[model samples]
Structure formats: C-alpha cells, structure tokens
Target chain A: MSSTTQIPFVDYLILDDPPYLQAQECKSCGARYFDRRNACANCFANNFQPVAVQSEGVVTSFSIIQMGPNPYVSAIVDCGGTNVKCTIMKVEPTPDHVTLGMRVKLMTYSMGEDNEGTEAVAFGFEPI
Target chain B: MGTDAIWIIGSNMTKFGKHPDKDVVDLAAEASRDALQDADISLSEVGVLGVGNLMNASAGIGQQLQKQIGQTGIPVFNVSNACATGATALRVAIMAVKAGETDVGMAVGVEKLAGAGLLGQRGPKPEAETWQPNGRFGALSSTEGRIGTSIMPGVFAQVGMEYGHKYGGASFELFAKISEKNHAHSTLNPLAAYQKRFTLEEIMNDVMIAYPNTRPMCSGNCDGAAAMIVVSDEKMKSMPSEVQSRAVKVSASVLTSDPYEDGCQILPDVNTLTKNAASQAYEQAGVGPEDLDLVELHDCFATAELVHYDNLMLCEEGGAVDFFQSGAPWRDGTKPVNVSGGLQSKGHPIAATGIANIHEIVMHLRGEAGDRQIEGARVGLAHVIGLGSACGIHILEKVA
Candidate 1:
C-alpha cells in the first residue's frame, strides 16, 4: 500500500475503512445535519449526538449543471430519512443515466495531495 | 378617512442598464432630484432621508447624496436588506411620516452592477488544486459549488424542479414560455435594460445558465436607482389639487422572513415567507387577490415568477401552471404581472428592485406609464424577496 496518509475533506466524513458519513442529530427534534451545529435549526435545542448515516440512498432531486468547467450532476439524496446534498459520480452526467429515484452509495475520491503526500479526499454518491 | 394614512406623492427611477459614467451616488442623486421635482418640492423642504444600497452599504450613501442634492441635515438612514433594500428604505420614510416625525420624507435605492456576471461562489476561496482549512466551515468549503449549488440561478432552478416534481404541469417548455412572455412584455418598456422580444424556441435554444433557466430567463444585473417621496394624509390635504389627485396611497407595507420548518436547509424556502408577507399585506390593505389590477413581483428568474404566482396567491394552490396557461399574466390579461417586463428583462439592480417595482406600480396608478399601461389600473401590488430570507410586499392604490 502507498504511504500517503488520507484526510477527509470535511469533518463529518470518516476516512476509516469502509468509510461513511456522520450527522449531528438534535436530541429534541431529531433533525440531522452534516456539520456540527450549536443548536437544532428546527427545534433550537442545543443537545445533540453523532450518528452514523446510512451508506445507501435514493436520489430525490437532481440537476445536470453545465455552467462549470465540466458538466456534472448535482443532486439531493435521501439516505435513511436524512437529506444529503451531493454530487453523483462514477456515471454519466445526463438525464438518462443520473435520474430521480436512482439508488446510490457513499464513496470517497482523492481531490489532491499536499506537499507531504497527505491526500485530501472528498465524498460523493455513486450508483449502487 | 384615517388621518394617519401615508401617501406617495412622487416616485421615479433611472433607466435600468449600464451607466458607465455615473457612480452609485450619482445615480442616487439623479433619482432623488427627479422625485423631488415630481413632487414639486425642494430638497430643503424634505424632513428625512433613507438611502438603500447593497454593494456599498457602508459608505454612507445617504450622506453622500445629501451633499449633491442640498444637505438638509435631516436624519439620514443608510439601509441595506438585500434585494428588498429599496422597499425597506421606502418603509423608513413612510414610518417617519406616519410617526409625525416628518411631514415629508424621501427614500432612494441605488446600485452599480453592470457587466457583473453570474453570482460567483461566496465564502472561503479554495486554492488552485489543494484543499485548505477555512473559517466557520473549517476544512469544508462553501456548499455553493460542491454538493448542488448555492448560486442564485442554480438554487432557483432546483426550487422550480422540486416544485415540478411535487406538482405536475411545470415543464422545460412551460418555463421557457414564461420567459417568452416576460421578453415580449419588455418590448413595450422603454427604460428596461433589454427591451428585445424572444420566441420560445430562441429562449430554449439559448445557453442554459441552470437547467430550466436560460440566459434570457434570468435577471440581468445592471446599474440603476429608484426614489420616492412620502407624506402623511394631513400633509397631502395641504398640497395642491393636482398633486393630491396624482398621489398614490400606501395601502400596505409588510416584510417577513423564513419560519423554521422541516426540509433541506441547503435550499432556501422562498414560499412560506412570501405567502406570509402577502397574507399580512392583503389583510392590512383590506383587499384580496382579485382586487389587484396589476402586480410587479420579483421575477429574478422565470422559475421564480411561476412559484411566486402561488406564493402571492394570484392563483389557487398548485394552480400556477393553469394560471399561466390561461394567459392571465399578459399585459392585456385580467391580472397583469411584471408589466415592466419584470426583472427578467427590465433588469435587477439589487437595491433598486424594490422601489423600482413600486415605481412601476405608482406610474400605472397615476396613468403616467405610457405604452405598457394597464388600463384603468386602480390598485397594484409590488413584491420583492431577498434570499437572506427577507420578503417585502407593498400595496398601492390610485386616488379617485
């Protein structure tokens, strides 16, 4: 195995083996958020707990973005009752391929490496 | 019959488009001077001033304007509330007049955004290749570019798509057709940034900034300013008969923000706040949707126009598609909307939009809007919603 150490691009993304995402669940309202929150956006409760998010999800909404340097699919995936915004990967960015109700699973890919060979990994959802 | 009622005696707006030679203050002073002229009053007689600007909110634009338009040493309020800045400024003047603090007040909104392209990514700038830790979001970048998009066009596009997904009837073609209507309406607006008409095919075939929103469908960012002069009912009766006859009554002025709800927090909830504001405005005005003769809403995007049709209660719930298909929003239709070609073609100069909308309505109420005038328009509504989640609604009525 290569000696490059992997770093998750975001705090909520776990870079361990069989990597998955985590959410901050509000104890009062059960509202889940990817980033750390001081208060629940729904209930305004300060209490929270970290919970593992389901790896698999279904696409609820998507848009084939053509404005950027390259065309890509930007989507909202419903993963085990939690809505997660993500980019769909490992598939063509077209209406026929990436569509609503499509099933997808969490995956990580390297964004780039720093001077000391620390790889910054970003997360996306791919067709399961 | 209420003596506390506020009236708008004069309103004016500069032609919305590029003004390379003039700065923000220059544009603001011109609008302010013209509004005072329309009111047949002098700046020396103005009691208070409220200036709205988003791009340069901190520069004391109100004071700068006073320097050019004869400083009255009145209480100057520099206001900023995103796209609703103009209306907020107008509200300031109205409140002052109603509170008896000032018999006459003026509000001005100005912006210089010509040639400023697509809403760029906001927040920490990512390096050319490698990722770096940033403020607030930490190592995570702004959610704008990554997951879906936070850009105005992209967010509004997704909002429209989600609406379509929930309710049938919204199609790519339907959205394009909505754009065609606005572009066609622009042809009659001499001061609109772009007064060109486009066919549905041309709009759909043009470059797509975001799905369902083409270049022609999105609001053009440009330079412009709008100003208004307000006075109390007591003050209005003292004015000349011609000025009193031309004045428009402020039926309602309401502003609202998003209420907490269960949904994707990433996408903005443009519906609830708008509905709340509209409900409160109608109640205050003692008028319902059918009573309005014309409306100038924030059509920042064509998709936005469709959704706002429902938000503003211009149609039955889940009936925007039917309303559009009925050809009711046309200039000649029952409920004429965006008669100034809307933001889609009239141009959206952020701060100027709110008062600019009010200007359109006031002009129609006074029977001064040439060419695109809504016949015998007695009551009109001007609505604008900003994404920091503020929605402002104003109802105006012509004096019979």
Candidate 2:
C-alpha cells in the first residue's frame, strides 16, 4: 500500500526533461497523431516513430467555454507544423486574453487530486 | 441490371419536440406504420427492418413494431453512428434492396430524449467517480479534454473560432445569420420544433451556451422519429400508381469516417469526409453540386453549415458569407438548403435528425413540401456528420 503512483490522462504525456508532448509520426508520410494506432492515416504505413513535439506554438484557434464542462480557455495551437490541441492556463478566458496567432509555450501542472491524493498532471499552452 | 440503384417509395416522420405522453417504441411504431401506409403496402408484405436510435435502449423496438403492426417475421437490423444514425440506417435499407436481399425494407429512426433527463443519466455515477483519474470529466476529447472539460458545445465553439481564424472574414455574427436563415425556413414547416422566426440580433443575444454560440444557434434535445421505405426497381414497378408517382430515387448514398489527423478535431472538417462522399455521391448520381436544387444539411451548429458550404462545394473557401446572403439557399433561390428548418429550428432528436433530413429532401423532390417547396425542384442532397466521428450523405431524385 506504500507504492507511489502518478498518472497523466493518457500515455502521450511524459515527465522527462524539457517535458513535451509525444506523438506518433508516420515513417512514410510524416503524419502525426496524439493517440496510438496500428497504421498511418496518410500512407497506411505500419511503422511510426515517437517524436517529441516542439514546446513553442501559435494559437490557431481559441474558445472561452462558458458552460457544459467548465469555463476554461482552450485552443488549438500549431506547434511547428503539427497541431496541438490543449487548454490555456493561468489566464482568464476572455477576448482580451485569448488571441489567435498568439505565441505560446507548453507547460505542465497538476490538473486535480483524487481522493487518494494521486495527482493527475495535465499539459497546456501558456501565452508567452 | 447491376445491384446499385435503389429507390425510396415512402417516408414518414412524427412531429418533433417534446412528447410527454409518447414513449419511443410507440413513436417508432407509428412512423413505421405510416411508412408502410405511404408505400401502399401491408405490414405483412415488408421484407426486413433497419432501425436507428442512439444512447437509449431500443432492443424491444423490433418486437414492438411486430406487435403494433401485423406480426411479420422479418429480419431487423439496428445501426447507430452518433448523429448519423438515421442516414446510416437508411443506407442499410438501400444496400438491402440493391443487393436483392430484400425487395422492400424500412429504415426507421427514433429518439425520445426530452423526458429522459439525459444530463443525469449520461453523467458518471458516484461509484464510477472513484475510478476516474482525478475525477475529471471523461466524455470530452482526449488531450483537449484532459486540460478543459466540456461536451459538444466547447468543441464546436473551438471549431467556430478556428473557422474564423482560417477564413479571416468569418465572424461570430456570421453564425447568427446562419441560424436566422434556418429558423425563418422553419416557420413554414408545421412539424418543426420551433416555428417562430427570430432576427439575427435576437439569435446572437440569446442565452450563450459557449463562446460565439447561443441557445438558438445550438441544436436542441427533442423527441422525434422518421422512417423511409425503400424498394428495388422490380418491387417499385409493382407499386400502385399513386405511390409510384411520388417515389424518389436513391441515386447515391455514401458513408465516411474521420481521417486520423492532428488537426483541430471538432470533426475532420465541417464537411466530415464529405469531400470524398460528395464526389462519390455525385458520380453515383451523375450530378454535381451545380445540379443540386436543394440541400438538407445537418446544421448541428450554424457554424457547421457555414463551413459545410465550402466543404460541400456549394461555395468557394471563405465564401459562405456572400453565398448565404446572396439569397441562394432560400426556398425560392437557386440552391435551397435546410428548407425544413434544420436541427436549429427543427430540433435535433439525435438518431432521427439524419432521417428527418432525408424526409425533407424526399418531400421536396416529390413536390410535397407544401409551403416550403422549392419550385420545379429536380434533385436534392442530405448530409449528416455524427460528432467528429462518421458521416452519411444521400442524394435523391424524383421519379417522374
């Protein structure tokens, strides 16, 4: 009962140096995905390489969600060439704060703590 | 002579919106009964059943129909693909007829969500919360959901912003105009959930569900059902003159799922895989977007319809504003779209929404739309995308 356990939502998250999101990039077509799969979408290639995404990105799309789940600022950020969908952190989800094409850097922190004190750390894009 | 062509001889839909007294079985059975009547065939004459419903228990629907109608021991196939449930069922029916597996099959879709209290039902129970890591909402999309939590509104709203950023000309108000067009179109449709027209200002000013989307611009939960009776040419030839006279040909039916990608994933595109679907549909129907007289697209959100205009090839990229305001997709215009009010005004009953779109197109093709009829309508297309998941597109032509 003394074993320590920390979990990220999905297997894509890594707690390594200069921590960044890892995605599956197709070896043939260079298509990348956030989830694991059997084959590449573009070329149907079975071989893929795990690539760490760039930490810096540009906000291609942003939304100020007012209802349903929670009022959090979210955006689709284009990191280098691939798109990274993440929530915006440490800023209000208002028109003044969330701007398109805004430069952002990847950041990770504790999303929430379960009843057993296990931390679920989530990654997000913060305005630079 | 090939097993490719199919025809929809009859279609029926129950009145949409909240039905406090009626359960789904009763509603689906009624639609099926009316469909058989419309096809001028007795229940005992039916060959098979393809029923569509979603996120609700419908295991008894087949037996319920058998009891309501004469006990016809026909095979029943149920299909579900999110919001595309109806069209998916319709495709199954068409394939059945085309393959000569059944001469006459019925595609029926129903949903009774109003009294179901979906929010309480869909949410996690107290016991399940213990398993959820950090007790975060699980229904939202993967990486995005882990950061923020939401259902459809937040994802679609993000699509709205992404659309705006891409086009640079698209605005939040542009989405309101799309809603107003569909709402105005619904006033002439008695079966639509909301027949009242609203100004664009009123639509934008309504209760904000998410950024850039108000209640009026969002699809609503409702209880509704739609059914279509499809038959092969041989079976159709044996139909009565009255039924045959109004029959609509199912020229093309294409279903596609999202391509695995890393893009903003509200859906692959507002078009779903519609580019591939529409092209294949056009080739099957031997018609293109230019040949379409009317379109009954899935307007789950006004933004979807706007982006779909480009995706469907009805307009150029970023040309939705002018294409909409140009008075084109109106009832009397060159290419009328969502003349049946769409999900915005018609209310989205999930599974029924797709078939309801088919029902409207068939009615238009047959000159039976009444007040919302597109004069001299020749061909129509209906498209629906189920989440960022799957899509179904059907093209219909009136048999003269």
The per-model lDDT (C-alpha) reads: 0.86, 0.78
Candidate 2 ranges with C-alpha deviation above 4 Å: A1-9, A38-46, A68-70, A112-119, B1-4, B57-60, B115-146, B261-272
What is the lDDT for B20 in model 1?
100
TM-score for each predicted model, relative to the true structure: 0.94, 0.90
CA RMSD for every model? 2.3, 3.5
Give one digit per residue, the lDDT tens place, for model 2 in B37-124: 8888876667888888885645756566667766777888777888999888888878777778888888889998774432211344
Q: Largest TM-score belongs to which candidate?
A: 1
**Listed models, DockQ each:** 0.50, 0.40
Write down the lDDT that model 1 would get.
0.86
lDDT of 1 by residue, B1-400 (tens): 2337789998999999999999998999899989998998788779999899999889999999989878868999999998889988988888888778889999999999998887645656645354565553456456555566777887787677767766777878998888999989999999899999999999999998877788998999999999999988888999888889999999998888888654557567889999999999999999999999999999998888999999999999999999999999998888999989999999999999999999999999999999988989999999999887889999999864
DockQ of structure 2: 0.40
